[model samples]
Target chain A: MLVGTASVEALAASAPTISAWREQAVELRGVTCLQVTAEMRRAAREAVLPPALHPTIPAAISIQAWRVRDGDLGAFDFVCCRVSCRSGVRARGFTTGACASTERASSGLAGIFGFPTRTATIDFRQGYDGADLRVEVKGKTILALGATSPEPMGPDDVQYTSTLNLAHTPNGLRLVQVEAHHLASKIDRLTAHLDSFDGEAFGDARLRPYHVVSASIASEDISLPGVRFVCRPDELAFTGTEPVSRA
Target chain B: MKFGIFFELSTPRPFSRENEWRVYHNALEQCRLADELGFDHVWAVEHHFLEEYSHSSSPEVFLSAVAAQTRRIRLGHGAVVCVPEMNHPIRVAERAAALDIISGGRLELGTARSSTWTELGGFGVNPDDTKITWEEFVRVLPQMWMSEEFEWRGKSFSMPARNVLPKPLQDPHPPLWVTVTSPGTELDAARRGLGCLGVSAAGYEEQERRTKEYHRVIQQCEPVGGVVNDQVHTMNFLYCHEDYRVARDIGVPMVTAFNVANAHLYWTREAFPTRAYQTLGNAGAAMKAKSRPADDPSAAKGLPEGVGVGDPEHLIATIKRWESIGVTGINFLLNAMEMVPQEQVLESLRLFAREVMPKFRDPGDRSRVYAPTTVPGFVSDPTC
Candidate 1:
């Protein structure tokens, strides 16, 4: 069995604490999500994930930028980068880092959902022809994703896997399972081009995109539910997974 | 219904030379026994880099060995992964032809574009091109087998005109099949007039729906092969015992072992986000949903529906359900991860043959529609 070899301490470095986790579920309407997936350099694949997860073959990464038109935290844009991995048999994404357009959006993401977030300028746009995302931190451009040739597809065509967020919990440092439900109204396949990326800013300097795989944009109602499960970062999920304690 | 044994040649952990040797020898023994018991076919899958789950990477080689041992049983070189990186069209035709000649024209050719990123990425196969490449492979293979000299200028590869040597013993070419793991692939099979070799575990309703759609679509088929192999052969597990509890006691572990091992592979959709791969295509999705801990004794009371497990009666009923859904054949995976001992697997085959198989076998079976029709390179009246 292939397991990740990254140290728990290293993975938790960019993870928020459970102190920010809330039990309330937040639902955002009319969210336009543009996701670009790219295969990462295979040499540093194992170093990007904790031991509880298994790195995908030809290790890959997904960069998702979402534009929220209306939400409890008001309208804001954010971009999240995740390493594709597996927790036991199910597909999961290991979040490396996230950047929100506004401080309010960053705090809401960090305090409510335990996202490892910081305030940054995010330009996320979707039009009839294509979708594009640009992320800038401290007046320096960090990432840019451009997708073209929008081919309409069914809503069920795109699958969003649950995410594993490595965070310091009340109990200990655990990989929290953050599952968001999406009801997509429309979806389009796109030809993706990754113009620039700074892997260092995305929590790991070694996390470089080797090849662009695919891109898609979806109009969806995104819901962030309360945390349900967490697993020990150093052990396999079969033995280490436990239910989240309400207390 | 036609009953066949499928081999993954799943060797246990501590994957030593001795363990691999034991797996091969045991599989040969099982094949010999299956032939003696009047089993119809022996299908071997082609997989790569899938440790413990499937070690039979070179299925043509394995099927040739089985041919040397068995006399009457047909050899199914099931699903040579139809990727340009993994298999060139000419090479696939050459190997299948040789295997067919070795088996005295009893070879059934099955093709597929693999689902796992483990195999595809290992071979450096781009996920987007697999479907197109598979289409090109299937379209060219028959031409290679039938023509004195064949050439192709295609998207995946271009070959100069040359006689693909060692033409198959079967008149035009062997029956063609395509392994259906993804949901819409049955339509691909139907449209191409190839057999639907279902390698995944789908429920009765889903299977019925797919069967209906397949039959509906094949009516307008533009065949990719010499003859339209209008058959639906589902893959399942087989473990029979007089006592249902005992069957569950020994059998559930093997199934669990196989499911876990199958799930271990990184699927295409998980790694490469694309419309090409929508779901994790395998038995892992369907079977894993209802799986309990194999050692959970409390879980061994009733028969799992549609599985070839439990007593002979239960096996009969399960086979009947499949038959009712227009499945022409079933290929059984006898052991996985070598979870069942060699002796026990043999015993299970013997018990199933004696008490369960006879109940379904009929001299006038309608599934004989799948038999070699006198009209070569064409489909007979499928309405029978």
Candidate 2:
């Protein structure tokens, strides 16, 4: 998992209060940072989505599999990948890392709900309040999880929060906003696939599936250079030191 | 002074709920108007996945629609990216021939290897291999067009040649044009004995130099296709109105948009590291925003100095400059980036036909303008 964080206050400042913030959130929903480390181990490796819908979806369904040995990482890995759809049309290649965010969000939602569930459209707006990160996911509410003891608390504490704000607009069920914080450890697992598959695939490759082995919410304040986020006095603060923010 | 109106089928502001359909119908109307006005050609570009800059990804379908409506105006592809990933050689030859037959021999094939990374990487084409693939496709196209049964085994593309159907009406084949943006490619086009379609945005001096080089190379050429070539055509931006300032005000934005969009789609992809070509979505806007005055007459800005905004008189002056530079045909870009209302474009065409075309269409002027040169030995048909 590749864990990264961006300042929510900064994002909010950059985005407009009404339309821009909501649009930015939706745009952020497409962010991906995960990488795959295993190839097709099962024959019934159906593409995650229907073929007709592949053109519009964030993740590509078709992929070529390859094997690689990562001496630096000290692991053997298998990967499935395809050229980005946008790049394929332009006849060029450049792998974008942010696509994994969508995959992680999809998988997390799928785990909480069930398979073959209709994807609820969600838009996330990110902003920074001082050093604290603020993220809002707006859309149709499907599944909402409340925080349990020992489980980390998200902003609204429906721990697995899925809120769909349909009543806000007359056109239809458009996402409005749901605020949250970036729990670094939880995000680390959400984004783990990004690192595991990097060295395993050559050239442009599709992201690998997420394998959530373990996840924990840090309760202590963590400090890193060039980063400042305020945690509740008793609550844990998760800090990311990487210069680049994948989400 | 032959006229060809350009259509990229762009959709500007107020993208209606049914914007796509409106744009398509609008383009067809423009083609019909151009045909009615006796424009010599109607050229449509082939661009994929570019939202507003270009919506006509399927030029074959669009051209066929135009072919059904227009009578005299030649139907042309500003380019069909000859790289195999975008289209196989056999497919290209077959489609071109079909369109030719459908258009009653009014088809002109303009071949190119696309410049943008968005197209190259999107189709999983290796940039290094595109040139080879294009060369192979171009070489095979003539065979597909001329032979009853064609078979070829090439390093990049291979096929057991079968009878390709709907042979073109133009004797051996249709007139061949290779679209070129650079001087090197112009020379290459000349060496292959193919007609040079100098599609660059360079000023008249640079175009003159490139056209001179093309003529020089054609003089000592070895044909790459099945037949030799005789003429070179250059594309220029032309919007004519009674009011020169109105032409500049309205037409300049569209022309500038098209040039910047084309360049951005082509150049910025090279800067990034990737396996598939993707558009630098912001690059076009950034380029347009950073635009500066073309004070330098000799800069390689890809546009002729006197282009963009002009009246018929101004257009005549520009054509005179191009004529002095030895361009055989002047392909005026009439409706660029879908700017200029259809009525306005038709008005511009009608005005040019009345004011500028008459002087160039005179027999005396034609004879003085088109220089006679000996046909190359390999020409299958010297009539063109």
Candidate 3:
């Protein structure tokens, strides 16, 4: 669980003009599965009717279990949304349910309604020119009535880490429990299976089920940064480079 | 990997109403040829009120016509805008069901939330609400198709319990897909167990990563439809030729023109000044101003780097790379900005089928394979 009070900063003075990427680290409060499932609609209803002094809504919300880039990290996606607080203090970070990858983020988010805490923060680093992006979530007093649907692993989902919850508490809202389930995914299997292709599975393997598809590399004259041209024997020379989000 | 063709139905500058007719007829002719030449799918995009960039607003009508003309090729909605403001849920289901029945169930329904401010605002769709509306629209769309009589009361709409007619020929309805342009949408698509229709002209490196990520995540994705269509289609440019240089010369200009024309669209950021446009404009190539390159055709002789736009060898190599990366399908943007003459586009399709398709054929087609020494007006690899 990636939670707790947190502050983190990373700067690389590669070049004052530009650093291929800048020191783009900031703290962000996550918009929980609860907020997405409830608050938006409730905000709409409150607009239509009277504003509830204590807005309570029951929701059986199924969170799109966000997969991490690695163990306890952000998603493979690198998108960011900059949020500004009432104090005019602004922080920018990836707009992903990344913090949901942990029991800590769930508990901290749950703390907002449960304990009525002033603010809770956490530290996480994205591999953005190797810099840390920190986020601080200010607790909201709006009471919600709903239990988060337990995070269930998909048909072939592989669970490497933890889970987050959105449980309604008499105190407010708290994450009931976060646990790791059993379901090894094809993604995890890819990492394990990529190097084992011994060229024995070429022609027959083309029709094989549960395999990744790719186009052969071209561009003889022009060199691409991380592309390998497929040789005649049809063997792969993979770069093992991770894809970065333009986010 | 499957090979498919895409159409935006662009009518280039220096034309009037006659060009629109020419564009549609030319596309129909192209589709006929693709159907005969053994292409997999003919995916048409849905765009509204955009001049030159895309003239295809009514995909069902166009696809219905294509369906009547062809027999084998799969009919796909590159995406039908899922925002209720743009298209009512029942209408999409009815039309898709009708098309599926008409086309003998060769329908792949791809859905999306309107991105451009032009389409969204034009149809009175709130930019902020489009995502939620899209989610609701997809969730209930299947219910409408599957249930003989369906009723829905949600944030988006309220439809009384009534029989939605014309059940699809495909059991339970057509395969559902989501048009993904924004980064990280693949995961959402997987979570809902929908196909990832990558509309962007993302390079192979990016496509490879996306495909890998998709296959990885989709295994555990919860299905939004009746069943998961665990497929990924990478959109690309296709202008195949006998000569590598000729293919490069013809295809690159079309790509650049298409990109430039597409970028000129009135995004939400431009009009509303806040909302989707700001984030997407910075992230997409839409904001990049483009100009017509000088008349030196050699200057335009190179294909879009990391795209399938060169000669047979280049395309073969590129398709092979994408196949190796685990892309289940390759969606080729056949005509862009109307730069390529219709005759040339048809010839390019024929040439691609002749030279490139054979390389990826199943084991049964080994007898038809083109040998290395048969240059066939193309440059043979010196390395070979």
Candidate 4:
């Protein structure tokens, strides 16, 4: 019954464009991901989400930083900001903005998967006791997060929602459903502290992270499969879901 | 096996006082029919801030209204959320006692720690502490009912010595039960010598496993009340019609509507990551993928086993499967989203009572008496 009220044009202003849907899956191995989630203020509950998705109660945001040791685009780090939401009953995240450590990685990701990515200085480190992430744009720190007191848990204990990336495709301007498969060898839950975040640099000024809910670090293999579906940005997913591929 | 009706009191969109009034009155009408048709009990859920999914936040009031309307049908004051913020243990005890007195001792007390962040987070309750808080409430409620002056120095709440007033009409207390939503919670019920009120939609295999574990552990339990309630009451849907297609046509959408509304609630695991909360709870377990194809040969036989839809014959086979696996009783949800017309709902209850219920009980068997003396009762007519 509750639908997001944000204008699709405003949301599409900063979204990356995808020329075509990739038919092949992209694989990255030995990736260390540090994900920090925090509840956002209620004011941004529907202001940041497109109508196709439903904003979660007491809106929340997740900031994830990944260090890819070996991948198709070579060694690089990536940081992305996502607003938590639901895409027709399934939990999904709307990617607000992202930055890649290298130009090659940024261009590759943007072209293949519509990752709203730009090159930035990203330092993501994970040790036994703690994990830390710092994202810098033009020598100005945009986001910094620290997670401590690591408690080991099984990899299956963690759940990852699919990402909805707004992008221009062959069909039209649509929200691409990009699902990823993760096979993790290690996972840890941590107490997190948000040191700083520049919401404007994250593509929206209302994207500020409020109270921290949880943080986790995992060592895993990440696979991004080809896009299978897209939905109209201004309509509900129940009525807007359009399949992009037969498979 | 005992049969009861469960009410979530789901009111669909355009949630107005008018809409809520209609839902309430319609549910009351159904309760009246269930009572007249020899149903054992009527269980009302306690939920808050969950729009459309459940508007029965004040179930004690709702159950009291039912108490005033009907006799013989037991009142299940289910699952007064045993959280300090949502409900103080003292208030829960006092209210249950009052409801028991009002219902003439025909009351079943059900306790639970809520499973939704929509509720726990709304009340500012820390999800990690809910288990311990629920533990304390279950232990102290019986003591409050039995003691003349009760004092508590518990981890979640504390109070000076005070007589929790308005003792229940039952001799010691009402039958104590804990709602089992997440896995392993039935063990908590068993260890506390409480009844297992399963609210989730687990299939026969998983339920049989849980039932086995519950029966085994309850044999050595340290009960939280004067008597241990070993009953296992599983929740189900009811949409009986003589025509099988009619039942499927109407019943599947009601189930889907309830599941979707239930999924809208923000689950505790999604918001707060902790061992205390594991699964998404409720709709997560209930919303299963379509396992059988439409063209499957078994499609003509009517709905699958354990689904309480279809013709009376299908429901009989389904309930027999449940009984085969040791389910003591079942609580049926008659309607959701008001999908079934009021007249049809009343008809479904009447039809099920006439066709399916008799097969389970003897000719002279009547509704179980709630309490020996204080409870004013009803003698069910076999001809009805």
**Candidate 1, CAPRI quality class derived from DockQ:** acceptable
Best by lDDT: 4
Listed per prediction, chain B TM-scores read 0.92, 0.84, 0.88, 0.93
TM, chain A, every candidate: 0.96, 0.17, 0.17, 0.97
What lDDT score goes with residue A107 in model 1?
81
* Docking quality (DockQ) for each candidate: 0.28, 0.03, 0.01, 0.37
What is the per-residue lDDT of model 4 for residues B193-266, given as tens digits with 9 covering 90 to 100? 89999897677777899999999999888776777788898998999999988999998778767766776677
The per-prediction CA RMSD against the true structure, in angstroms, equals 5.2, 15.8, 21.2, 6.1
In model 3, state the lDDT of residue A245.
22
* Backbone atom clashes (below 3 Å) for every candidate: 1, 72, 26, 1
Single out the weakest 10-residue window by summed lDDT for candidate 1 chain B: B375-384
Candidate 3 residue-wise lDDT at B333: 87
Which is the winner by TM-score between candidate 2 and candidate 3? 2
Estimate, for each residue in B182-232, the C-alpha lDDT of model 3 and write its tens digit: 767777788887889988777556667778888899887656557668888
Looking at model 2, residue B307 earns an lDDT score of 68
Which candidate leads in DockQ?
A: 4
Where in model 2 is the C-alpha error above 4 Å? A1-247, B13-17, B266-304, B363-384
Provide i-RMS per model in Å.
3.1, 15.9, 19.7, 2.2
Instruction: For model 4 chain A, give the 10-residue run with minimal summed lDDT.
Output: A152-161
Estimate the TM-score for candidate 4: 0.85
Candidate 4 per-residue lDDT, tens place, A1-247, comes to 6678888888777777787777888898899988888888878888888998888766788888889999888889999998888887777888888999999899888877788999999988787789888899999999999999988877766667789988888768899898989889988888999999998888789887878878888899999998898999998887899999533
Docking quality (DockQ) of candidate 1: 0.28
User: Candidate 4's interface RMSD, please?
Assistant: 2.2
Q: Write the per-residue lDDT of candidate 1 for residues B163-266, one digit (tens) a residue.
A: 88899999788999999988889999999888999988776777889999998999788887677788999988999999998998888777766776677677
**lDDT sort, best first:** 4, 1, 3, 2
Report, for every candidate in turn, its global Cα lDDT versus the true structure. Answer: 0.83, 0.48, 0.53, 0.84
